[model samples]
Target: METALEKRYIDFDATGFSNEELLTIYKKLVLPRLIEEKMLILLRQGKITKWFSGWGQEGISVGCAYAMNEEEFILPMHRNLGVFTTRNVPLNRLFSQFQGKENGFTKGRDRSFHFGTIEHKLVGMISHLGPQLGIADGIALAAKVKKEQKTTLVFTGDGGASEGDFHEAVNVASVWDLPVIFAIENNQWGLSTPSREQFNCKQFIDKGIGYGIEGIQVNGNNVLDVIRTVRSIREKMLQDSKPVLLELMTFRMRGHEEASGTKYYPEGLQDEWKKQDPVDNYTLFLKEKGILTDALEKEIHDSIKHDIQKNFDLAQNEPLIPAAIETELNDIYAPFTQHVIAPKGDQKEMRFIDAIQDGLKQSMEKYPDLIIMGQDVAEYGGVFKVTEGFVDLFGKDRVRNTPICESAIVGVGLGLSIAGMKAVVEMQFADFVTCGFNQIVNNLAKLHWRWGENADVVVRMPTGANTAAGPFHSQSNEAWFFHTPGLKIVYPSTPEDAKGLLAAAIEDPNPVLFFEHKYLYRSLKAEVSTDYYTTEIGKARTVRQGTDLTIITYGLGVQWAEEYLDQHSEISAEVIDLRTLLPLDTEAVYAAVKKTGKVLVLHEDCMTGGIGGEIAALIAENCFEHLDAPVKRIASLDTPVPFAVPLEQQFLPKVRIDEAVKGILKY
Candidate 1:
């Protein structure tokens, strides 16, 4: 029972290829197939812990590689071992990663298919499937902006096509006319789930029509057909700068990994596909053309086996990864010099939003690779008009608008950063950041510590409740990322600090969440420096000095405490504005607590699990002996923000801070 795909591949014409080229393609297919078998053997022998076979799908990957320019980027999934081999990733290094050797790409910090060399422009796959597609879009976007003629080919399984990232990435590419090919290797099974179970489309390629992109399908096992189709797509992409959906229809001939069996598949399904095994069929095709004689075939097979064996031996002897992973985790953020340029003349007075826009303009002018992306950040100038003139100044390529997909914005930013470009992504509203929380907490925050790569991105979030925007729009969500390590949190309260901190964040080599209070966007006015300077991250500013009680706050709380102190002249308080939350200024906090002997932590976030507790705990731990009174925390009630103006005001615990300050002074 030959399937339509198998019959199509069996009759595929190699009309354009010369005899020598046919033989070369045959050898390319055989090498990965042999490497796949060797990897399975190593998995069984405990030399490797896991194995993913690309045994039946080599034709698609190899053929695509054959048709691609070496300069084009490839974001490949785990099953595309042929892409690695084709890109000249030495077999010894591949085996070294598999065996968890120190000589591997990630110094054995990563395993399985998680490996790549920047020189080859191939980003190794992450466990999360759909994000790489978005990453590919970012890479292609970068290429387009830089006036490079390269394209990006990103692959995913049939199951991954259903991911939100797939929709987001393709849509962005279509609208932007980016040179990214969405290559879906439809190998019929995702783990144990069949393609039919994963998607309802007649073909995965059919969905591209809705995205306004050209769609093409080819038999996965036909090397010539795959190469020919991909070459055409690449040419079309170069000419029009539009993306194409290339679906390679094939079947997985083995279980997801070596430890699993194919029992879930129909009994004869494996044997049937093996009859059309790409490597064997291609070899037969070459033989029929008289390009592959028995002697030449034996020589080619022996040469590949010897190469794998040599690499296997080197891998077995390579130094084992250290018992502790801490040694290899240094240089999380790449070092860069910092300098402050003097103000050109008398400092100019500006609102917080203007300061932000100026800071972005300066940073982009300095760093050519820096990109700013968000939902209305481009031609429309953003909903808040914070980036009103940016598109005019930097063009839409650099300051681009995105669809209202918060997660995809962050996800694409992560990709751009990984590809060695700096990105600043804006979440139009701070509360809406939850939509892309996974990329922030999971991907961006973990990359540097896990694999010693910088996730250099600045996520600008317009935060806090002041416009009476109600529950969904008004949230101080810094606490969510405060709990996440390896992320720098910057919440600036003044125009001076906003401009300086944003400049520093742009220069910093790690991921930073820049929290811009929506309340202070136009309200706060100050003399901002026209020249560039970076207010140091992890430092606090003493807004007001007092000795009666220490009041620690940030964002909107800073204004509340200042207003309260201005009214009540008798009660003295030391007001500390924590610009960065993750790296708290313990020295400033300790000195304040010691001088006042009483502490009150004030914030607008919900009371139970807010950053106030962390500050209170810090005061109790390090400044406990200096404290003459107990540490008190004043925060909003544990309820969603209501729409009523009075209720929202009272719900934010603004007036309560005054009461806590008075109570702490009395104690």
Candidate 2:
């Protein structure tokens, strides 16, 4: 084996670039440095509160961005001002965003450094260190699915390679042969910590070999070398045979953030890095090649200063985010206030499983981009026959079967969603969702909030306590996602509601968690509309009207509540099925509870930390004055669901009409 020093650096003499191209690289590098200096001055003057410098790593970013086609996508990390500028991100909006002005791309939600322009095909910058690799894989995979000849370039720091997301993304991209280039800007520092403290590997590029992919290292300070390396990899990636890793050895001339002073860095390290500055090195190379003269360099610097000032002035004069922007949340999920409704008419009754199948078929027909995949869901019709004959109805391309790796399944689905496909991933059972907990909570549940409305994916899992399945198989984990921020959790009790919610989730532009009750799949039937109809994701349905008590529940619990209401006519119970859980229908719950002056929170999960507790707390804090009696909670016992039929019954909440009537009577 070759020594680490020999392997760490690759001879780039084989790859050639013209003098003009080198000068173009020099200009790109100079622009970002000038922009960064201006932004840094603004930060010190308190005109901008935060900034992350891209001073030393400019050559790598500009070279990589220039190497890719204009149509290609780039997902950048925090330290990527050069990439953004090279991709033509407007400097005005970038500065406005930093100043927390309304004219910013994210409307002040994100800082200046975390800017992106979809029109420019620059996806966006994520402040979180390493996770953008998975997002890039997702976008690249999307390009492959759409048959677009676009490659995705993702940039991260050497320190970010230590993150588990980095490994997960690289592994999946290699396995799926995604059109992506993982570019590591090895600046030798992760914030204040040195790269040696994070990993023992001499070169981060070699780490790609473990995932069955090719790896290359280059002098990141050499713009021509970085561009040549990226362009070479771009050719292979576009063919979709394998993903490539290019480690660009660079340095961070400034501290991690504006607030961070370089107190931890060695005394002369910054000055040493200054000598090897990518912009300075590239400028010298261009001048040496006669492509750029001293006069031309001075002109470029002066032009950038003028451009920066023009944008800064425009941003300062721009108006703040409109007052109506505060009400924009109302427009996020659905246009409920618009009062748009399809003609409500009675239709034939169907089982829950049949409704799911029919809804998927309708959605697929409506949206050609929609895709369905799960274990045994293609030809075998799924474990529960919910997707029976889907492979035949839709082609195999639309209906996919996986290798039973739940984490990979969901992780790939997340990638597909990022690629702009409406991916519907299924967990064989609710309990099996545990296999994808990391993907769900860390990626799916938080994508939209973390990235600001670009994350879109739908995950469906069959849940509820089936008596014979035992503890491992009979679990309701909706509560696990209920507390998560960006996820929209839906639990439908009726066949009609299931079909509508499922269709809506497929159409939604955000990540959604659809939980199907196992016990109700075959047993329950309702008259659902044959014509396409969709219920809002975060809305609740008031099934029955009663003044005595309000029963707030979802999924299987709603069915039990219905039966309870049917058996006891003497005491009327208002039943509200909280179809969606994340943006919990707090308004509906509070309204019903206030009217009835009594509330009962119910769910199939164990009482501890279940969704019911959240609902109970909300009501107690908001509707305490209206309550005629203390809130009641009916949920499964605090234990794993038992295997025995009798024990399972005891474990679940089997509240009948008589039990509800007695509780109301006592109240």
Candidate 3:
């Protein structure tokens, strides 16, 4: 049963390693294998809810964790249980995590290997497997910037290798020469589809050639081969700071999970792979070399099994997580105590676009660790020229450009923020964000909620219509992010708020979607402060005071409301500007609603599923008794933002706001 290697490790005598070194490697490989076996029993008996089995592939995780320096990070997917156990995560806590204990890594907010331990430099996986690759790239990028000699060992499966995040992450890593080992466990099947069907490439390592990086395929069942290869590779990465694509050729000896058996596989376990089982064969190899004995093997198994069973039993008695999770939402975002406005500073005339660029410049100056990336924001000054001269001011490193991979770039921003650096990702147009929808919603928005990690990242979206960018380019998609909690949304209409809000969004220690209307970029101008400052987020600004009725709006609707009221001075319409869409200033909204006893919620986004509906609902639920008229909502017509100028104007809410105000007054 001694596993014969294609080639002996080092010399025939195991030249470079001592007896203890070999035994330690064997212990690390055997630990998770036994722990997972215990977990499978629990799953069958209903002690734990679920399990993503790491039944077959322990060598890859062991080799990577054993070779990695303690300071280096390991971002592992679901099957890499060895990565956690070998990285020295406490057994008690991990067992508690598996059993849904309240004191687990995510405090029972999440399950399985879906949580990360920052203290141990272990970032866990999301079920959406691919985004972790981009997160690893972000971590490597931060290490490179900080001049730390660290490389990240991140994993994906045969199925995950074909994902767009895989393409984007590896491309960005190669382009930047980041120190990352993108290890793909080619486990023969993605649930049931074989590797041959999942990708047409000859070998998973073959992908590195396209990205212009070194590629290597290791015999994943051979623990000695893996440990030696990974240790050597880490040395080379430290020297060059270059990425390598490692293909850990292995198989999922069990089904994808316990629920699905090997029935879907069609051609079940081939004899060759069964004989090459990583843990059993590695144990035989150690025994042949006198590194381990029957007594030692029994002792290791008994001791590890004892720890696993003991922790599982202890965790079962632990109290269930408190049902009132709504209490923790406020603490997810880091507190911000910064200048709300410029302090007695000189003022100058500036357009809305100029003020945004100036605000970004000042933000960079204030937070030296802050970075901004987008399609052309670095050299091209972005599509709207908002970053016109940012390159000359901030170096290419601080103001970087990214490939047109929306999802990956947003995940990269999250990764950057996770590594203690603030990041801002600019979507070329707001409509294009749909391409990155999963990352923004799942990865960026939920990072803090699930992992208890603050995300100090800002996504700048150039939205709104009337310039004839058509449906693909023009969209008022603030509602898309507003509905998702744990994200802050800000939409500004004036030059002053644009500068102040951008500063605040960047300063806040959470993911913020900042919507800047393309129509208002150059159309508005005013005296702006030259000093660095930020406007308070989540608070509405009173644009004007009146008693007849209240006009509640954001973005382009604010401007149209002002213009309509300016023309007819006798209307006496009070307008409230909702600068921050999420964490809404309900106090200001309710105050305005009660004073006028009539309210009109307006925005340029489509009326259906728009934020105006949420505002109207809020007014109805809380201020029903104080209202004299039913709350009315005015928004652009429910259709694509059209191409023609006249149609676009009609599609916008300018005329509708004028009519809604008049209609609500008569109500």
Candidate 4:
């Protein structure tokens, strides 16, 4: 347990680098800082709306930037602008992006330092901090699985260091010995909160000891020290296939943002930190060693000023992002095609779980880049044995068993998807998806519409009520995602639909939530087609047809509706199983409502804010004239699913579907 002061700093040798190389790195360090000052000018001039200054952290950014290969990735935060500048992101494009012009990387979808060019291996950061740390682990995992020698570098603030994602990513990276570096930019403050108030630990470097990874601290303002330490750590990570936690000690010299005044910081703190500024101090250090002369220094400053002025003026005159909503909607998902291999047999009888297993096997075989990950999914065969024997078939590299961190599992899956690999992630129980809800809703769901990027990821949720399993294990949470715009939700009841839809979801070019009914995993069996086929997403299929009444349902609700119709043979009830919930198959729903002239919507989820309400409304708007009776909805009670069998039975609305159907028929 060495204290921060007791720990020895690696003395960097100045003789290792010639004057030219040191000057180049210094030039890279100063450019972004100067540009940031120009941006502050733009902010005051009302040319740019907001700016997060990279004031004191240029040394860490530039040092880390120089350590990586041109092709290696640096998943950067807002303060790491030096990484972008070092990577040679065009001055005009970077300024244009800051000015919200159409020629930028995100095409004005994002104005702040919230965009990244995939080609440059510089993935952008979202407002939420730690999720990107997990994604960086996944990118490193992808490189390892593909046998590509690549290292991923991710930066996080001391505040973000306390986030759960940081722990999950470190745990995963350590367990797998991933090639990555978790660079904690310890700027002494997380927004207005001091580091001491955020964590009980004395230093962030010691936090890595609990996770069994190497930890090192560097003087962030010393560009030479940072560059030497990062270069050595990066080399070790690539050679040994282990992650490192490097803490860069520095301070935020300005407010968190231009608008956030420094009133919260201690008095004279900004001026005190300004004295140790990386750009200025490092320049003075270079001049002392005779590596940088005043004449040469002035030349660099003049050159940067001229360049910044030219780029800033050009950025303001560029075209703005298009105002068309249709274009934005169209870019929400990238187009993808799937190769289907028709089963030789007409159909084969199989359980719902087996059909899912078969679908995963087929997809993995067809697409070599397909990766399956979840808790106990590899050697343990998953909780329900759905992924049994997959590890032996695809090997441990492709079929991985992840820790119980649901958010990182999904976050990593999202990263893999963006890197052009298909990842099928399983949530042990759909009820626990709340742990990863942020990643699903904010990052995975919004990436496409936000930047025209496709997150080709499928999260297989083992959903619906399991008899006596209690609240946490037994929940149908599909309706919650229905309210979100950029997600596709799929719930299948039968073995055939399960196999086809799972395959479709794996190949679909969008982030999809595939809900599998837990009760039906083994109980339901049918002769599913062996051929490679996918039930089209966003389409509804009529399980049973009748003229007197129409019942639209999905998942276990479909089973309940069919059983009720069978018992009352003379009722003439039509049952429509909505395969995909998000793209509501309005045509199929409208046709059924018009023909029967009576409709009932049923689901296993709760009634309030349920998909049933959406369906009921869709019917009222479209088929109002043809309906003989008002469209009604039946769903579970608005309470947590109880553990007791009787209470659970009462909580679910399955039994009441029969009564609703009878009441509808009479109307």
Candidate 5:
């Protein structure tokens, strides 16, 4: 709760620095300010799209980066240009990032400060702002789990403090006792809103009291204060294995971005803050300390400006990202364990839930870097007890029970993935995925595609209806993440496929969403594989073959299709089970359509925007010449799962598949 400036570097010797280190600090503080100025010129010249100014806040960015070890990471925001420079990320590549050039870190995939390269140990921010805090928690977790001597620092603005992710992430970090420094640059304004309207607390650092972590406030305009404070708390954070929230108090001397002028600024406020400008203050201190002279200062300025102009000019003329399907879509997922592991033998009959648990268990045994986290997955054994007895087998360190913060946990998984850990996060129910959608869609889904950074994480989504669990608990929501490009979706029907595909999902390098139907958890049973095995993610299984018709389905739909055929044995049908949704097995689908000359698409999801629609389109577009009849889709009515048994039966797509099958035959 300490809000006052505990230490100030007034005199030259007060900073406790030799001349050489002081000069380095001065250079670091000056570089970002100059970069901002140069980027503004580029913006005005129509060379770049936009730029966020770090005009007065260089001290916080520079000092924190300078204080940390080279291997320790900083999840930075747009204004933390000093972080990239201090980390020695090549200047040419950094400028190319701004120019949307192929030579950039992200291969021109992202033009904003939204790219992270593991080589430099620097991950940038997403526009959402708050989720990165949890990612920092994961990075710290990796260092702790590996027993590496490292600490992680993350940056956020005053405005970012209000986001629910901030609360959730900080709490997760504190509860886990992670070695993280949550550095908040209190720059007095977020866009046009001042700090007065953001919060009523004495200062933002006091917000840390609820989490029971130490809070420190420093004068951000004084580079020495930022460096010293971060240095002072880092050991404490590491030794105690806890987080520290450091609030850097400063002013935004300019508008948020270059184009948005400070027209909303209070009169005379910018002028007053100008007096405490970090770059100017640091330069004056260095000059007075005899660490810098007029000639030396000019030499430093000339050197940096020359470096900036050379890099910027080269980046300006660099080749733009190619305009082609192959180049644009390449590297959506990093290389993974694609070779399937052959099963040893068939085990005794087991329920669908047991198969899922078996897959997760086998995955843990196979990969030592794997960690399983969810709401109750540890000692409590998850909501459905899917991970029951896992903590004792795997130990508590690996089987972690997470707080009910869906968004932050997902972000944490992403961090773990970046730090080279295979993370499995089980959502209590798939419907709660809405709470963490941004992290899945934006952070986990995009990182590998963005920079070839593997997101080796699996989100086990317990989905589907028919248990009368009502709207919240009984939603078949795999379709929600299906439309996104970077995520892999798997929906298995039989217990054997569930075990194999779940194993595949965990082994895959990209972020995979494994949707397990809640209705099938205990209702379905089969003889599953006894040994660890992985089914190819994008392949389809032809469960039943017939010449008369083709019925393509997955998950609960597979059971329904078979049940319909059982009731009416007259209809000869070939049922193809699409175990994976993302990389749909187009070849198998086309082959089935070609053979039957009629296709019926069935799924448990609602009619609109369902996987059925995509299957129908693929048939219509690819097999138009071979088909004798138009493709038909059967699905549940577009509504939330109902509470009443009668209503739930109507909402489920049981009888409709039979009707759709008969209708397709007549065509």
Candidate 6:
């Protein structure tokens, strides 16, 4: 009773391959093995620092690489040496990368397996597992958007399947039906842990079903079987314009890397797997089919060995990277010069919700390339009705209504942004962002740092607690992103500031995590300007002038401080709203702290790792001498925001103007 999936793979085995094809498979396996062994020797001799052998999984890598055009893109993992080698990455450069030499693909900055060459059409390998899947989706989507003929193939491990990124990437690829292939190398182990222990599911291919994508499990040890199956699947994918998942059932004969040993593996598992070695098994199959004579096989092996030795020698003699390379790389994170300044004269007032809507309208009108997307945002005006009339105004394409997959929503936004579109993806609620955290933190946040100014995306999330919307609906996770690098964080308290700051973020050539306060959406109103406007990204705004105390806050905290100041005119508290936290307005903060000589940091997030601590540390280190009193912090308690109205209220930051005023007055 074999299922359709199993039957497809079984049929692949019966498909006949020519003698030349069999010989080609044997050559592919031998070449990769020789290179891997040479690198292993280099690792042992301390010439190569690390190595992850594709010893047992060579057949599948070779088969998939051969099936696709060399011009098509590939996002590989650390164990994808076979694919890279087969794609024509020079062996000398590959070995040089391992030895940390200038001849390396990344000039020795990256590990050997993480090497990539634009000329070879192979995108660099990501050391972190599963992230390549999202990158592949982006590359594939870019090709589709640009009407390019090329497709993208991404590799991952069976253990990587358990990670949230795997599900996120697959879901987005399926929804978009992008020309992409997700090849999973089910090597039976995730480091020391067995795949069976990592997941309860019997088949890794079944996981793809949840995302509404086609998937197949193949005998990866069988070179022809793998090649035939992948070829058919890829053809169908390109014709139908869809994503397909191929789970290659394979084994790992070597340790996780050069540093790890297989002592913890199950008894006799390695011995049992050795019987099905892809290279040896494929060579025997070739000989049985009369495709490979002993003399020809020996000649191929000898040539590969000699070539590997020659490359290894060249790599060992390659020079080191120059000091200037490191110095040039540091300038990527330098402060932006085209800063947005505060509005001249009196500040315009507006409701926070209307401010957000106005900001989107202004940004969209300013940049035709800017797109607004999220669940129910196009027609339904979003969950909070903030994007009301956007679709009617901008049409369907610009204001897209997406499916309920948060990860896909964010991933697609990132993809679109990288493809030269300014995308503003809304997460209906702040709490729902947990589903797309990996896309935000791993892909979007790290993309610019990894590639340098190539990936600029903006993610707008409406967050904060106050609506009695239970534990699942209420959350303040700004701290999670405030600490993450390669991102611009903006949380504005006023409608005017929201509109101004969001416009600035959309125009800036960087990825931004724009947080819109849910409770402040329409709580208040003011006269917003009809003219286009943008505020500075990292600079803070001083709302009041006072000498006694400095209150540093953003978003709702700024509103709370304003309210607290209204009640205590005697204290004369100077409130500074830090609209952007990542590229923090340290200049404004230090100046304000110097003027007041006393500081109190406030935020809606939990105390631990909150932006408050970061600001406190900055003030303590730079402005410590001017401080007349210790810096105090006011934040939510360290716990999940509860559903109970009383508990939720208690969880919020308590602002006692009298106490703060009296305390700072004494100093």
Q: Whose lDDT is greatest here?
A: 5
What is the per-residue lDDT of model 5 for residues 1-667, given as tens digits with 9 covering 90 to 100?
A: 1111223233333357778888888888778877888988888989889888888888888899999998998899978888888888888888999888887888877866788888889998888889899899999998999999899999999999899999999999889999999999999788999888988999877878999988899888788888888888987776788898899998887778878889999789887777777777667666666777878888888899999999888888887677778765667777665898866775779899999999989999999889999998988899899999998899887999988999999988989988989899999999999999999999888888887788888999999898899999999988888888888999999998899999989888899999999889999999877899988899999999898899999999899888888888898899999999988899999999999999888888899999889889888889999999888888899998898999999998886776777777887
State every prediction's TM-score relative to the real structure.
0.94, 0.86, 0.96, 0.96, 0.97, 0.84
After superposition, the stretches of candidate 3 with alpha carbons farther than 4 Å from their true spots are 1-13, 267-271, 335-343
- Alpha carbon deviation, residue 82, candidate 2 (Å): 0.6
For model 4, residues 315-338, the per-residue Cα lDDT tens digits are 878877669988777766666555
- Tell me how far the alpha carbon of residue 452 in candidate 1 is from the true structure, in angstroms, after superposition: 4.0
lDDT of all predictions, in order shown? Answer: 0.84, 0.77, 0.85, 0.85, 0.87, 0.77
lDDT (10s digit) by residue, model 6, range 152-265 = 788888887777777777877787778888898999899999976899888877877887888899888777778888878877876787888889988888888867988988
By TM-score, is 3 or 6 better?
3
- TM-score-better candidate, 2 vs 6: 2
Query: What lDDT score goes with residue 618 in model 5?
Result: 80
Candidate 3 whole-model C-alpha lDDT, 0 to 1 = 0.85
Q: What is the Å distance of residue 421 in model 3 from its true position?
A: 0.6
Give the clash count for model 5.
1
Candidate 5 stretches greater than 4 Å from native: 1-13
* Winning candidate number (TM-score): 5
Off by over 4 Å in 6: 1-29, 90-92, 100-128, 144-150, 192-213, 263-276, 280-315, 318-350, 362-373, 392-405, 415-422, 451-453, 529-533, 638-650
Answer with 4 or 6, whichever has the higher TM-score.
4
What is the alpha-carbon lDDT for the whole of candidate 6? 0.77
lDDT for each residue of candidate 2 in 1-667, tens digit (9 for 90 to 100) = 1111211122334246665655566678788888888888888788888787887788788888889998887878777888888988788877778787776776666676665566777766445565567667667767876788888888878887787667867877787688788888899998899988989998987788788889999888777787888888888766655788888988887888867878899888887667776666555555555677778877888888999999999997887766675454543342223222352666878999888878788888998877776788888889999888888788776787765666656766765666668788888888888777777777675555433444456788888886579988889888888777667888888898888888888877777888988888888887877877777777899989998899899888887888877876786788999998887889999999988998888888999999888898989999999998888888888998899998888788874335645765696
